[model samples]
Target chain A: MNTEKILLDHGSGGKISHALFADLILPLFDNPELSCQDDGAILDFEPGRLAFSTDSYVVDPIFFPGGNIGDLAVNGTINDIAMCGAVPKVISAGLILEEGFLLKDLKIILESMASGAKKAGVKIVTGDTKVVPKGKADKIFINTSGIGILPSGIHVSGNNAKPGDQIILSGTLADHGIAVLTAREGLSFESDIQTDSAALNTMTRQIIESGCDVHVFRDPTRGGLGTTLNEIAVQSKVGIKIYEPSLPIKGSVQGVCELLGFDPLYIANEGKLICFTSKQDAQKTLEIIQKNEFGKDAAIIGEVTHTDPGVVLLQTAIGGVRLVDMLTGEQLPRIC
Target chain B: MSLKYVEEFRDGALAKQIIKKILAVSKKPLRLMEVCGTHTTSIFRHGIRSVLPKNITLLSGPGCPVCVTAQKDIDTFIHLCKQDDVIITTFGDLIRVPGSGSTLGKEKAEGADVRVVYSVFDAVHIARENKDKQVIFCAVGFETTTPTIAAGILTAAAEHIRNFCIHPANKLTPPALAALMETDGIHIDGFILPGHVSVITGTHAYKDTFEKYQIPSVIAGFEPVDILNAILMLIEQNEHNTPGLQNAYPRAVSDLGNIKAQKITSQVFEPCDAVWRGIGSIPSSGMALKKEFHPFNATKKFNIQAIDTPEPAGCACGKILMGLKNPTQCALYKKKCTPMTPVGPCMVSSEGACAAFYRYN
Candidate 1:
């Protein structure tokens, strides 16, 4: 605990590594299976199907407004499993640290992961840590893998979106991407925006427990809502028509996007999910989602159309229609 | 946060009214070339082509700095990256532009220290931080970007930042317009001038081109309403046979433009004969650092050599930029080329015509 910085010996599996595991990580993620010092967790559960999802967080800066890479990594996989209509149970954290990383900063990150697990009622059952030379990698990178138990007879997928189905967004879009963007060192812009990185398992559980014949659940993470909708359209072999005015966006994020010439439609999001449901159940599903704390800004942004299979269209707020194509290449900030 | 003027210019009713006006005034088939990459994107993003009358066609021009950057310049960047103790910093737009053997992106993946910077100041800061390494900025842009880069060089010189240098491939808008007008089989009725570049160069920059070509032209903003209104003006001018210049984007652009910025740009750099990707060499079109600031020129400082090379075979980016052919007409488009594996700069740059077509189509 008195170490000023992380050393190569900390990942060497010697006495130093053991002390790091025992003194730092183990107590924060203290659980029966993890404390046993086994290679992996041995779990016992009732007869059911389980969903397993893994994601890596290599976001630049690592720390941004509202959250750091720690919670973002945990919440990312948790949301991934939640999108599969399952209750996330446990997660494993993998940290790859640069040699000169500060132990104090690592503790802050670990504390964030522990609190994130506590909030979601999940346990960090197993983990690994590694250290590389100073120039081998960025300051820190985290990888999280999680397991979830699916409810009986739950069938939700990107392919399930049918014609006439309503598309519901869980909340406002593009917070996580904008937050990281504004927090970047060189390209920093002043904005009161923060990452909307949160556990979506509880909110997703509410919808599945409601049992209203939900067709699809997806987290629009890297490609934003526009690309995600295009994906659903292609997967379901249907066309989607989204209304621009109904979409929710914070004015500050929108302003930043405007200045940078970025379309919020293509920016990344972390704490939101899109649901496609039948017309009759759409109202009920939307209301149930709206009741959740994370789903406060939820709205039906679009609908699946019978025509133009595999295409996504946006009806502009100003009364024009434009095709929302799949985002191509890295969306760089524009000079014009 | 809700931008008032932004929302006003995007007014649906105003766009509809302007479209109606364009429809009523149009008499003959017209090909209007929007000379800015940003305008091309805005036009396609709003389905402007779909709304316009069948007779009127909007063409993407050679305005994208990335798309127009010569292959030799790109090769020079990759070559510099291969040298030891050198770091190449560039705008995101030029990172993907293909050279003869590789791109800056490919070199970076192969262990080169290639960095993507948003502005010239970022590269200067990188040089200041890494005193042991030489930082070469890939300076490629139009008037909107040149002044900023010039300012960065001035700051670096004042601070005596010896490690900081730039490989400037900067271009001028008016010269490129004239080059296009002189090309054979290039018949554009009117020009939709660049809004941002015009903000720096002003409406007066196009006066020479207008006098020579006598083509109806309007400097238009990137909003749907502004574009529609400009289209109506161009339609009226074409119908009346009054081929002249007008500034439709008066709010941001003026008669003289940003004089201080222009002055600084002139102080730091001078016009030199520059080769464009598909457009060949245009006299005094490219900007190079002045002889007094040779120390700030990366090519001179590092003794790097330019590799003269031709465009990729079957890539119709030049013709496409000239407005002689649409994106689909390119032999390699969506066949041997795509955004993922771009065969030309037009497909690589976000502001490129092929990229705009591929995205919105």
Candidate 2:
């Protein structure tokens, strides 16, 4: 507690390591399973299918407008499991810190992660920490792995999309990507853009419990909606047609994209999900999503098609149709 | 947080009305070429081609600075990066553009000091931070970008930043349009001129080409409504047999253009003969740093002469740029040539005709 910066001894698994965990980590992520101090946490679940997911957080700056890397890491794994129509139960955190990384920053990140788990009604059961030399790593990196239980007769996957299924986006696009890019070291732009990083497991639970016929649930993260939709089209052997006018994007985010010559469709999102539901239940499903705190801007953006299988088409605002191809390489800014 | 102009330009009802007007006016089997790469991208991005009449063909032209960058210039950029105590800073697209032997991205992976900077001023900042290293910015853009690069040079010169320099591969748009008109087998009825470049060059810049060739030309913005409005103007001109240069993007572009930016560009650089990637060299189409700014010229500072190299075999990027061929006409397209493994710069740059066609089509 007296240390101003983390050192190699803090991760040695000796006296210093235990003191660091008991004083700093344990107080924030307090729980019965984590307090036992065993090799791993033990848990029991009711009769159901198990959904396990893991993700690593290596975002630059490690902090942004709405959220930092800590909550992002926690919510990312929780959303992954939730996308499979499961209720996320417990998560494990793995931290990699630089020797000279500030202890204060670590405390803030840990506190956010703890709160993120509490809001999602999940437990931080077990965790591990390691420290490398000062120059060996960028400030800090986190890996979170979580498990969830799926209820009976719940089925959702990328390949489950069928003809006539309406596509519902949870919210606006490119908030997280633009927020992080603008906050980077040299590229400075004045805007109030914040990362839409939040736990979506609660929203997913409502949709699953409602018993509306659902086909697919995917969080458009790294590749955004464009790449994720292409993946679904290929996986389902169906075509998709999204209306340009129906896409919910913030005006400021669109402005940034125009200035940098980036397509919002290909930008990343952290707290959004794309759900595919039958036409009969699409309206009810949309209403359910709109009621959630993170789904105020949820909209039915597109629909699955029978023609042009394996291709995703966008019905442009100007009444023309074009292919929304999968992202080729990193979406680099145009020269002119 | 909302942009007023962007929304007004992208209004769905306004775009639909323009499309309807274009449909009614476009009667001839005309082939219109959008000279700017940004126009080509906007046309595809808004699915403008799908709404136009079947008789009208929108051809992509040699406006993309990165796609039209010569192999020799790309080689020079990679060569500069390989030098010790040197850092090659460039726009994002140029990193993946393949040269004769290797690309800047590949070279960077092999331990070369290469960085993708958002602006030329950022490269100047890099030079300031790394005092021992030489920062060479790979400058490839048209009139819309050249003024900014020139401004960066002025900043570096004023601050006495000795290690900062630029590889001036900048090009002028008006000359390229003239060259396209003279090319054999080229058949273009009208032109959807680049909005950004025209903003700097002004509506008067295309006067020579418009008068000499008697072709219909209209400056356009990148939004759907702006492009559709420009297309309608071009169709009306062609139908009435009145070939003239018009400016549809009057909000951003004017007859005189940005006079201050033009002055700054002339202060730092002069017109020079530059080679195009697929097409051969055109006279006075490229820009070179002025003699007074010789110390800020990367080509002279490094004493490196990049010999012109042959383009990749069986690539039809040149023909495509000239509006003589489409991407599918190329034997390598969608087969050996793709966005992931591009054989030509056209496939790598986001504003490239091939990349736009591949993505939207």
Largest lDDT belongs to which candidate?
2
Writing each residue's lDDT as its tens digit, candidate 2 over B224-262 gives 898888888888998999988999999999999999999
Task: Kindly report which residue stretches of model 1 are placed more than 4 angstroms away from their true locations once superposed.
Answer: A1-3, A36-39, B1-4
lDDT of 1 by residue, A1-336 (tens): 456999999989999999999999999999998999988899988988999999999998888999999999889999999999899999999999999898998999999999999999999999999999998989899999999999999999999999999999989989999999989888857667989999999988988888798999999999899899989999999999998778999888878887777889999999999999999999999999899989989999999999999999887744667889888776887655
Each model's TM-score? 0.96, 0.98
User: Per-residue lDDT of A143-219 in model 2, one digit per residue for the tens?
Assistant: 99999999888889999999999999999999999999999877989899999999999999999889899999999
Question: What is each candidate's DockQ, to 2 decimals?
Answer: 0.53, 0.83
Quote the positional error of residue B127 for candidate 1 in Å. 1.7
Model 2 vs truth, CA RMSD: 1.2
lDDT (tens digit, per residue) of candidate 1 on B1-361 = 4555777887777777888888788889999999898888888777788888899999999988889988888888888899899989888877777888898988999999998888889999999999999999989999999999999999999999999999889999888999999999999999999999999998999999899889999999988898888888898999999887999999999999999999999999999999988989999899989998999888888786667888889999999999999999999999988998999999988889998888887
